[model samples]
Target: LLGRVDDVMLVSGHNISTTEVESALVSHPAVAEAAVVGAADQTTGQAIVAFVILRGTATESEDLVADLRNHVGATLGPIAKPKRIMAVAELPKTR
Candidate 1:
């Protein structure tokens, strides 16, 4: 009820909230902020994709990405894990 219907993603026939995924990503120590979206996937119907801003003290690396994915899988379920995670300097904003 907090977010709009558009914020909900039909991933593998399961309704997953973007906010829920974002929260899970942000819970990681290295993550400062996160945004999640569902992308077209032939296999799953929709795949979770994430863009993350790292904490000032955190460095971006392949290992860190793997750790973040593992963290989300552990926090939520494996189905909630992001298919891809990209480190971004900033997220686009709108008024």
Candidate 2:
């Protein structure tokens, strides 16, 4: 049997799940894939950082990032919203 603990991040005393943040990101029409991680933050303890693979119609720009951040905020909540969003060509894969 194989098992492990759920990867949960603490932000301002709140439990934020990376999977939840990633799901919120992909829900945006412009996003193809997303990976969410926790970054050390002086105020929040940890902040949500997202790396996104955008759709063909999407471009990496300030407006797009703001839109994505707003999308996540609407989908989830302000707390679940990504503090930083980066568009990436691809995410590393392992077989």
Candidate 3:
């Protein structure tokens, strides 16, 4: 379903869905939740950027960033891996 939508981003000519990236990010043990957005890029057209909330015990660091990237890469391939991953205290929500 995500693969067929106009909301899907074209990254280096590859279709990338924000839903798929979020799913991949949360699959990592350290991640509790994830939100993904597409950022404009001259080379890739759009780049995947991820904001993540980590589990209580997980510490945010460069090593963790690399690990999460590797985790998503393993699950969704290199193309689906986030170009930027940032740990956030919370994701704003609207009811």
Candidate 4:
């Protein structure tokens, strides 16, 4: 039986912490902040996706975005890496 502490899955397998992705993003100078989500994926059981808002005059460039994704791979290994990242203007805070 599962207890209150039952684990959750995000992308690569089961029982992943959101902090891994968070730590990856916060390491970048271009990123102001980021929010991650575990969306359903038909192929992998789950998919890790990220929404980012840029910092001080940073343009929304693809290379920087790619670097951020690669940074995740470096920080948390390929398993904890995000499959997709979207740069957003603002976050949906209360929903």
Candidate 5:
């Protein structure tokens, strides 16, 4: 697997890798990079939340968010789609 064991998330009894979701997000032309996490959810056990950095030519918008979600769903699967996707200026990194 591309990701470590710890990166696996249990969502609705399905095992999902954060890297897989990240890959799906980055597949879109507008997305430069992506980070995904599993958040506690009463219904699905865990919901996927994504933080994405857009390409310089792209802008953040509600329409873009919807499009990204749909793109993920189509690229991966509906179950793999993120519950929420937030646009961020940059991702935290260690020196």
Candidate 6:
């Protein structure tokens, strides 16, 4: 995504910082870890989505999602807010 940034987003517009998303997800108390992806979106043109693994006893909640969204917005501004966030048991790994 560094060299082929333009090839990454097949949709219109670009304002999100992929690196920042990576950082923000890790910053969440509920998120033990995360991986960020670019999802095709009609509205944002290219929506950022986060697939996260939460810490022990931390379940996915609407409040967590909203808080994370707001955190990202406050730190990186609205452009960096993810369109969707999915809390998975674990992120798919590359063997």
Best-fitting candidate, measured by lDDT? 5
- Cα lDDT for residue 69, model 6? 86
Looking at model 5, the pairs that clash are none
Residue-pair clash count for candidate 6: 0
Better of 1 and 2 by lDDT: 1
Alpha-carbon local distance difference test for all models: 0.92, 0.87, 0.89, 0.77, 0.93, 0.76
Best by TM-score: 1
Better by lDDT, candidate 6 or 4: 4
Model 6 residue 27 CA deviation in Å: 1.0
**Candidate 6 ranges with C-alpha deviation above 4 Å:** 1-12
Cα lDDT of model 6 by residue, 1-95, tens digit: 25446324422465565667768878877778888878778776678888888888988899988988888888877777887888888777779
Put down candidate 5 lDDT per residue, 17-87, tens digits, no spaces: 89899999999999999999999999999999999999987988989999999999998889988999999
Query: What's every prediction's RMSD, in angstroms?
Result: 1.2, 2.0, 2.2, 3.8, 1.6, 2.8
> Model 4 scores what on Cα lDDT?
0.77
In model 2, what is the error at residue 9, expressed in angstroms? 1.0
Those runs of model 3 whose alpha carbons end farther than 4 Å from true positions after fitting are: 1-6
Instruction: Give residue 12's lDDT in candidate 2 (0 to 100).
Output: 87
After aligning candidate 2 to the native by TM-score, how far in Å is the CA of 31 from where it should be? 0.3
The RMSD (Cα, Å) of candidate 1 is 1.2
Q: Looking at model 5, which ten-residue stretch has the lowest summed lDDT? A: 1-10
State how far residue 4 of model 3 sits from its true place (Å): 11
Clashing pairs in 6: none
- What is residue 29's positional error in candidate 4, in angstroms? 0.9
TM-score of 6: 0.80
Lowest-lDDT window of 10 residues in candidate 2?
A: 1-10
